[model samples]
Target: MADILLTAVINKFVEIGGNLLFQGGGDLYWFKDDIDWLQREMRHIRAYIDDAKDKATGGDLRVKNLLKDIQELAGDAEDLLDEFLPKFQQSNKCKGAICREFAMQIEKIKKRVDDIDHVRKTYNIIDTSNNNNDCIPLDRRRLFLYAGETEVIGLDDDFNMLQDKLLDQDLPYGVVSIVGMPGLGKTTLAKKLYRHVRDQFECSGLVYVSQQPREREILLDIAKQVGVTEEERKDNLEDNLKSLLKKKRYVILLDDIWDVEIWDYLKLYLPECDSKIGSRIILTSRNSNIGRYVGGGTSLHVLQPLDSKNSFELFTDKIFHFDNNDWANASPNLVNIGRDIVGRCGGIPLAIVVTAGMLRARERTEHAWKRVLERMGHKIHDGCAKVLALSYNDLPIASRPCFLYFGLYPEDHEIRAFDLKNMWIAEKLIVVNSGNRREAEDLAEDVLYDLISRNLIQVAKRTYNGRISSCRIHDLLHSL
Candidate 1:
């Protein structure tokens, strides 16, 4: 940890030193000696810092804090450089005044650097001139596949239950709807279930029903996927689809359905035969209302966020596996850090997977993991937050503020269910019906359940009768 910090500080000092020496239009020559001394001194401290790197990284807080001080002092010097740059850049008549400003800032930075150096020497934290360690840089992420295509964790019961529904030959023309907030693996479950049952069907078609529905294109896509060629469609797209499907048992997967109208438009195009035909439609959507609208409440399958055990498994799987086929043997310390990191993902598969990929390229040391952990909120948002933002933006106006209030609490803190409702009541967020005499608490409870159903807040515990007992918001959602 100290080594990396010292290296970064040294590099920054080198950069500032270069700017002072070369980029200042040669008018700042008077300040060159101070800048050179700063750069050289930082490099000298690097060897000493590197010698104790293992100790600082081994949970030695004092050593870690000292390196942090050095890094911060370097930042102070960088800030002084920033302030001096514009004056050098400007075509000012008073070069002496500009040099004086530079002199004053450099003197302050020098004093701080001198104090740090004195501490180093006093502690016998000295390094020979030739000692320097290899500097490994930090890493970022690349475009990778979404969670839907990856090895799924924490959906065993869901898979079994949905598989039974899809494969039941006795069932009629069935529609099985899988609904949850974005990135909760609705499409992934649909795809997995489709793969499991499609072999039993005479024909299968996986069609993506995006927010904007295009009838002709969708019909053709369905046909193309199910081996119904364009050449076979002599009749209109809809009539031809019904004629083709009615003659054969089939499974059709509609991925990402936004509006109910798309289903209404497409349903007739499917076979109208009775349940004996064994034709089925599997739909995945973020909107639960549309799930019920199309498949009825009985047909809706609300996907839950992954529990801790499975979430960690999925997260580790993403972190270790690479093209080289080498899986990381994570240390216990790294594993503990990883668990804390995965907790922030709130059991959303996509978020966990995305965060794991971000960390995979980094060094598998505690400091590396800690560095990533510190900036996790923003780092996670790179891929997963857009999906979360959709759920946030779609939230009802009244519920939005209530949802934002969850962020105020520490991450993963459980809130008393009644206390949360009463706070909402106190805030007047719950709209009461004048006609009904029920307390505003009832309506507030509705808001809480609404968020839970949407997969935003999770139900921590339940009453004997299965009412919400305690509730907690996800760390990722808390960031939102």
Candidate 2:
């Protein structure tokens, strides 16, 4: 236990040191130095204590003194960190540096305590032959792609079909399109599939082309997924993409395609598949026409909203997660209200997940759930108008108009790149200089993409040609 605690303390110190150096703009090297010195001192003291324990002849007093000294040093280091942390947090400019330092300091203290516990456990072991403690399993940390407040439910058949298509070696076309209405789990389904089949493929990459589909952005995203690190050099996106795809059987998931031109360009870059290795491309979009165009007469996989039972089950899972199975036991009325709320979500997984998350932290009450259900029902009347209205109301006054202008287009209608830019300019919403219209357009596109990413707008469609043609609001989202 003592050893574990000591290791934990050292680990914490290392973490803080690294965080401070990196997050502080490389201005906190001295903090790292201090941590390093403390780690060395702790290590030496631990070694002396261990040696004294092994040699059990008249060294008890010496060991006790050494342990006291180590405790004093640890406490002093912790005190210093606590004092420094608040000061750094208070200082606007030094906030990042201070946070990094504090986190590292706390982590070190935790590790030391853990080490102490581990040592005690080892010493108390009854059977030396059964020394399983030495064989501690390594922590398997997973890579999680968090789809904020979005749920993928009741699409098992669609998900399986797409999986089969990707796994099929004899399929004529490498590109497969998953078509759906906005907020209908197109991206979520793709994400689920990617995670499932990621290990099967030689290399797999999921690029979120949710922004204004600039060819450069697409290329950069693909390059990053395929492990390209060099930056600042100018090159055509197609050339870069083709280079990344060379000799690799990769799954390139192009999310939110908007224009046909993007498909034309992408088609040129994707390698022609053979028997041994075949590269696959997956696209998600709102426009069935674009999906058909990209699929080249292939069957389009349309994602439907969740059914009532699935919606309730998804909501229940989000809030309860298997612990609170007896919904009838804990506020039955609230459970009924929750069911009502889920029903009002119109089987949309995104709405149910977000609403469930919001309700999770609140008290389970009939009144609360009733109010939420009523609000959701009101919002659904206009296909997310009320929900979006609420969200807009919650936003700072400055960002409201910027959000509402996005609703001028019809549902699943792809707002053009230049058109959105001109609207922002005409509205005087964005600042411009040197009459660089392209730059202004890029900024406007960025703002729109940010809103979409934030769940304010749903990315409806993307073209293989690399354009965002349309966007829509979730039924609940539009209400705001």
Give the Å shift of residue 261 in candidate 2: 2.6
**Lowest lDDT 10-mer window, candidate 1?**
138-147
lDDT against the true structure, each candidate: 0.71, 0.60
- Candidate 1 lDDT at 128 equals 32
Q: After superposition, how far is residue 255 of candidate 2 from its true place, in Å?
A: 1.1
lDDT of 2: 0.60
**Per-residue lDDT of 1-480 in model 2, one digit per residue for the tens?**
233334434444554555533354444444566567666655544444443433323445544544554566555565665487557545524456665766676567546645653543444312221133534332111022344433456888888899998778876577678875555677778878877787777776776553244566666766667765455225455566676678677887877775578777666766764336777778876655567776655747767778888888888888886476647566767777877788767677767766777777666778777766777544334433332333343333334446666656554455665667577655545534434567767777776765654455666777689667666655544343
Q: Per-residue CA lDDT of candidate 1, range 198-248, in tens?
A: 898899888776655576777888887777757676556667777788888
What shift in Å separates residue 7 of candidate 1 from its native position after superposition?
A: 50
Off by over 4 Å in 1: 1-149, 227-235, 272-274, 323-331, 397-399, 413-449, 460-470
Clashing pairs in 1: 172-275
Q: Which number leads on lDDT?
A: 1
